[model samples]
Target: MHNPPRILAVDDVAENLEIVFVRLQAHGYEIITAADGEEGLARAREQKPDLILLDIMMPKLDGISVLRELKHDESLGFIPVILLTAKADRADVVAGLDAGADDYLTKPFDQSALVARVRSMLRIKALHDLVQDQAEKLAEQTKELAAFNATLEARVSEQVGEIQRMSRLKRFLSPQIADVVAASGDAQSLLESHRREVTVLFCDLRGFTAFTETAEPEEVMRVLNDYHEALGELIDRYEATLERFAGDGMLILFNDPLPCDKHTERAVRMALDMQATIKAHASVWRKRGHELGFGIGIALGFATLGRIGFSRRFDYSAVGSVTNLASRLCDEAKSGQIIIQTRAFHAVEGLFEARELEPMTLKGFRRPVEAFEILGAMKQEEKSAEA
Candidate 1:
């Protein structure tokens, strides 16, 4: 009962285009025609039809070239492309495959065969689109939770410290980073063991002065909600431990209380991801109209682990200079920048493209410390043109 999938048929010859369009339209599908590869590419970007039936030879551009372009662009790479060409030779088939065509049909093909292939490709496209949409929705939901948790942090800092560290072992193990600590026992038992290598990350929204002076309390709460909620999801994805939130900021420990071989890099990754998330959500806010910014800091080191607080008013959290320095670094970071200490940088340098920021001074620190900015994840993808 639903409308048929839209198909884009690309060919230079008006006759060939007519035959393919007529066959597909007879099956009750909406068809868009493109007489050349260039036009096909343009239509692909604009309409993003479910399936593209492209002829091998065309003016201005060719099918193979169009396929290459489509696969290269991140946005269009997933759309299915089926080559409808006259060339049936092995060499032609190999060339089409090399160019990234999803499937191919020789010219003078059967109407039934054409319909079958189009249907099959459209089915796959529908599934792919559905999965992508679900993933984006999930990410958005996680972002929402992190944002809500962020607001709650400022109000229930006391209750959270209590609820989070239900068991004594959780207290010393750094509950923020302890995903499996429950498998172990109380916080007191954790301190009995030797310390482990771990990275600690601290992040905060910079420009509190400007935000408070310029924005409403409700607006400020909304921004915090978006940032924290999104960061929580990303932290879960990387399997990093969230220690606790400090005011409008958060403290996360990596390879902590436990050993995560990738803790250092994961810390860097979380920082970069949080930055990316804020930018992605900024537009959502902008649509509703709001301005926002965030800052991140990371440090790595071994620290003595233990629980400290009255048995009645107890909590689980990290201590030592590593934690302090990370917090200090975050406080000192500029908006939208991820600042990392030298030790932290070397740990993830091999995996990330990190650039050095100027040495920064901390309130309680004796000297200006070395810091670096994470540019992005390693480049593994190439740009491609797509129709």
Candidate 2:
């Protein structure tokens, strides 16, 4: 429902105000009257009228002053005004117009002319109001679109970061374990310092240092690449976490970051598979005048594990004597031998045939540590027949 346009008429002369109030009201506008400029401005502010008819020579405040005040206030500036004066002087008319009067009449104004002028100003106000409404709606829509785009950008960034983390993790972890770590999304907590009874396996090429010293750089990398590829597949197949690899050696861990039942058996089985695979690779390399053999050490002991290294390079490493024992066992193993720590050997005694070696004094230990050399896995028929 559209409300009628309101008009405010201000004049000290009661007859003039009465004439405008009656005339515009008869023409269907809601009319209000004020006795002087002060009252006019107050009514204009209160009602926010569509048009104002102001008398130029009022006592308290005059038309020009009221017009200037209305135009100065942004809230009231759009309302149109017409100056009513008794004098027909050109100078007086110019002053009123310069002070923002829309139109003026001398002594008296024709009711029809006054009504026509009001209608014209009302049309202009309607157009301005429509533009303002549309601008507000458009601004609101722009804000919504910006918010949606920001959310989309954040989600895209998160997905991209996930893909990158998976790529980096796959380089060191098996695909299944990599998936678990990547999905967890909290590498910090997963890699935090903790202690667990893990099976630690340390292995290296038997004569890698001599080979690297004599062989060309290209030949050395080619041999290392071949050695890594064959054993890497076996490590992943057994779902072992590779702690670190340097040159021709690797430190593999079991029951860490992710846990498994009988981790010692798992580590021993992977070692047996690694020895067999390297045996085949060593045969082919021997034909090319390069001799290489692989040995591994498996131990079951408690070790502190966590992420270690600088920002650019990080290793999920195990620290303490358990890792040292495994490395020392590897150092003692002859070519093609899979040495096992005494504690670890007891876990897999039924699955594989291993000979207990005499206690050997190893570095970083107070007493001689008992060890065993694994020969091979017992055949299924042999296991069943023995059972």
- Compared with the true structure, the alpha-carbon lDDT of candidate 2 equals 0.87
* Each prediction's number of clashing residue pairs: 21, 0
| lDDT (tens digit, per residue) of candidate 1 on 280-378 | 886686676455567888898877654456757654466678988888888877777788899888876656666888788887789988888777776
Error of 2 at 75 (Å): 4.8
Predicted candidate 1, C-alpha RMSD: 30.4
Q: Residue 258, candidate 1: how far off, in angstroms?
A: 1.6
Best by TM-score: 2
Per-model CA lDDT versus the true structure: 0.77, 0.87
Colliding residue pairs in candidate 2: none
**Which regions of candidate 1 deviate over 4 angstroms?**
1-179, 185-188, 191-194, 287-289, 381-387
Model 2, 208-253: lDDT tens digits are 8999899999999999999989988988888888888999989999
Ten-residue stretch with the least lDDT total in model 2: 1-10
